[model samples]
Target chain A: MPLLEIRNVTRRFGDFVAVDNISLSIESGEFFTLLGPSGCGKTTILRMIAGFDLPDAGQILLDGQDLAGTPPEKRPVRTVFQSYALFPHMTVAQNVAFPLKMARCSADETRQRLGEALEQVHLTDKAPAYPHELSGGQKQRVALARGLVNRPSILLLDEPLGALDAKLREEMQIELINLQRDVGVTFIFVTHAQVEALALSHRIAVMREGRVEQVDEPARLYAFPKSRFVADFIGHINLLDAQVLEATHGHLRLTIAGLGEMIAPPLAGAAPGGKGTFAIRPEQVRIGIHGEVTELKNHFPGEVTHFLYRGDVTVYKVRLANGMMIEALLPNSAPGGAELFKVGDPVRVGWRHDAGVFLHE
Target chain B: MSDEHANLSPAARLTKWLVSGPPFVFLLLFFVAPSIIMVVASFRYPGEFGGLAPVAAADPATLQGLTLETYRFFFSDFIYTEIFIKSFFVALATTVICLVMAYPLALLIARSPKKSRDLMVLLVILPFASNFLIRVYAWMILLGPQAALSQLVNGVLGAVGAGPVHLLFSPFAVLIAMVYVHLPFMVLPLYTNLEKHDPSLLDAAQDLGANAWRRFWHVTFPLSLPGIFSGSTLVFIPVLGMFAIPDILGGTGDMLIGNLIKEQFLGTRDWPFGSTLSIMLTLAVLLCVWLAARVGSTRGRYA
Candidate 1:
């Protein structure tokens, strides 16, 4: 049985529906993330799971028991807020020891657990300091310590690293994953950044407009998104409008508008003559000097419009004869990669048959 | 290269000094000088004809020289001592009451939608425009022996059957007048402090595992301490020196320190005694301010 189950939970505020009939089952010891833009209701769903809010419809089950009308204090869950809500007037030690104090635990045990929690976050040296005395990253670590000291069944994180700079954010991400592994508790984190979600989550739920767009592992969500929205939202994907020329025996040929015929693996359960969209990641499309000929499948001829020099990869924008533009990412290590692609140069862009996925419009 | 020198012209220097000097001079002449004269008056001898006399005049009727007799008389008299304590207790009560009532109101005003908050602020400030003496007189008719409020309170308490009830000329009436007269002072500072608070802090608290009461005790109450201190000081300091409400509503039933001081200065013609009492009251206000500053700094150190 799953440790936490949200069954068709919906939250509405007056005339606006913030969470629309979302159902999720989180297994024990999993790092789950709700990824979406602002106002997408991902935070609202997390609040419902934390018992800070009640669902307008449906049920929330924790440990196989229904949680209805339960206040946040009564729940066996905790949240590390985006602001790192450390009690401003309390020292770091007192803030970490709050949950235990509220639970009426023995003073010695509270002190011991507080010490362990602060040590886990490497903030024990500054335990007597106040929240305003700490840096942003340190405050977040203190918030993490306070949330985890309660030993809750699930730990909810609402954009925990949204306030940090880039270098600190990367460091904290590793710390968070390690902390989760050490504690071995289910975590439900919310964020709008795709890279952070992809880096941290065991399973991710992509949300848009108050609905779950897709839920899958990071690799699957990146490789084969089911919808145009998810494909466009996840990463840089070149979407081309195409017509299904033929479909047979798990192999399909698509005639993309403005670009010539490209044959690829057939989409599951899609019929011939049906219009669909083809999504291919920029890195999957290769730019070579002399590779693809007619017999080679899923190849196109184009001219490079511009090249962007990224640290690890060189990105080329290729324009076909029919005015369809495609982006191709070539690694910096490729032979002649740095000097080869420039403005107005004829380029051959090709990909494997399995690279591009046919997505429903 | 010489922008600083170019900016520091004579007219600019004169303008800056001109703008800042008037207020200091005004304070020196109007406020500091009078205070110094009053302190000096506390030591001088009172003449037989009631004007201040040089100590060498040697009036036989009044005290001859700079004596501690006036201060001694005030401290030794049982009635004046009781009245001073009575005034201190009343001011303390008013401060506590104002804090309790103003905190939630300030929070509400801080959080209310803009239109409603503006309307409410206007309502809070409207009472201050009217004359305080006129308001106290209005309360007289309402709190009279035969008034409906007195009769209703007495009826509920089972003290009076159904007829007229007398709550006038009592300490209760004095307290009621103090609260009514000084409510705006309490609300304004409390509202200002609460308004300056960043609401994201509260949302941050709720997103954490804190329940409502914990959220307020740990987050809201501590942040609102400045307002509490300011409001309490504003209400308490002024109420301690108030004589109008006590004299009008209390009559002879309850005489506070302000009334006693007024009697010494004007009624009993004792300027030295009144000046000494005024100095003590000033010291008391200073002590209250010191306590407030201490609490504010302690909260700031933690927060």
Candidate 2:
């Protein structure tokens, strides 16, 4: 049985539905993330799971026991809020020790666990410091320590790194991954940042408009998005409007207007002459000078209109002979590192037949 | 500091003084000078007619015609000291009652939706639109005999086999009026502080296994200490020296230090004794503030 199961939960505020009929099953000791934009019901689902809120219609079960009557204090779950939410008047030790204290743990046990939780977050030296005296990253560590001290079966984190700067966020992400690995706690993390969701979660549930769009492992979800929304939401992908020309056993031939026909990996139930989109990651396309032979059969001669230099890789926007724009990302790996293709340079772009996925509708 | 001031342009220097001059001069003239005069007046003897006697460098009244006679008389008797203790108790009771009544109201206003909070706060302050004395009079009427509230109370007492007792012109009436007049002071500061609190803290506490009452005791109440202190100070100080409420609604036994202080000057025409009492009240208020600060700091040190 799954460790936690949310069975068709719905939460509404007056006329507005904050979380509409969402169901999920979470395994033990897996980091799961509800990933979406703001107001997409991700945080609402997290709050319900933490028992701060009750679903209007659903049964949330933990260890196969229905959690309908359980209050937040009685539930064996904790949350690290986005704001850190450390009590301003409390020292770091007091903040971290709160959950243990609430559970009526023995004083000596609380002290032991408090020290262990602080050491886990690398915040041992900051035990005596008040929350206001700590930096943002320190405060975040304190919040994490507080959430972890009680050894809860599930820990909910609501965009805990969203307040951090980019560099600190990256550091925290690595720390969080290691922390989860060490503790082996079932972490139910909620975030709108796709990169963060990808880095920290074993499985990501993409949400849209109070519903789950897709739930899959990070790699699979990134490589094979099921809908236009998922393709646009997860990462940078060029969605070319096309129509299904013909469907073979393992491939579908698609036609882009003003461009030409192309082949994509097979899409189930892609009918002939049906409208769809060929979603391809920019890195999958190869951009090279014209007449430079490439392995890919699908080819287009174009001119580079613009390029964005992103340190590790440069993304070149190619204008095909038909005036259609397609993007190609090439690494800046050569010596004397700079963009190999400048703007207005003639180039050819191509991709393998199976490089992109064809999504109907 | 003088060097820093000297670096400023003439216009800047003049503008600096222009802003601070009025308040500085006002305090010097009205507050500081009157306090000094009162201290001096506390040492002088009362004239045969009224007010202080004429000052003389050497007179038979006592070396320099200014004696410590009023302060000596105050300490020689315990009746004046009893009024001080009674006034302290009344102020303390009023503060406790106001805090108990205002806390929930302030919390409700703070937790209410943003658009409605302004109207709730406005309602708190709306009572101040009427004259303070008129509002005290309104309480007197409510607690008066034959009034609906008094009749209902006495009716309950009658049913309980107890004799009907007076509600008006009693300590209860005076206390009710005091709480009524000063409730806004308690509510406003508390609301202001409670409103600024991040509600996410409570949510986090609840997630960490704190129940509703525990969340309040552990999070909300402690965070509002600044507002509580300020509100208590505002209510306690004004209620300590309040004379009109007791004069209008109080019985003979309901006398507070304020009534005694007033009688020294207005009834007995003893200016020196009045000054002496005012000085004592000032010292007592100072002591109360210091004691509150001490308690607050020590309590806050651990949490």
Residue-by-residue lDDT tens digits, candidate 2, A252-341? 888988889887888778889899888999989877764442557678789998888888988889898888788888778954345477
TM-score for the B chain of model 2: 0.93
- Give residue A282's lDDT in candidate 1 (0 to 100): 95
For residue A51, what is the lDDT in candidate 2? 87
Error of 1 at A246 (Å): 2.2
> Across all candidates, what is each one's fraction of true contacts kept?
0.41, 0.80
Candidate 1 C-alpha lDDT tens digits along B216-276: 8877888888788889888999999999888999968688888877877778777877888
lDDT of residue B204 for candidate 1: 52
Global Cα lDDT for candidate 1: 0.85
Candidate 2's error at B22, in angstroms? 2.1
- In candidate 2, stretches whose alpha carbon ends up further than 4 angstroms from where it belongs are A290-292, A335-339, B1-16, B57-64, B146-164, B299-303
Model 1, residue pairs in steric clash: none
For candidate 2, the TM-score of chain A alone versus the native chain A is: 0.97
Instruction: In angstroms, give how far residue A167 of model 2 lies from its true place.
Output: 0.2
Q: Individual DockQ of the candidates?
A: 0.42, 0.59
Restricted to chain B, the TM-score per model reads 0.89, 0.93
Clashes of 1: 0
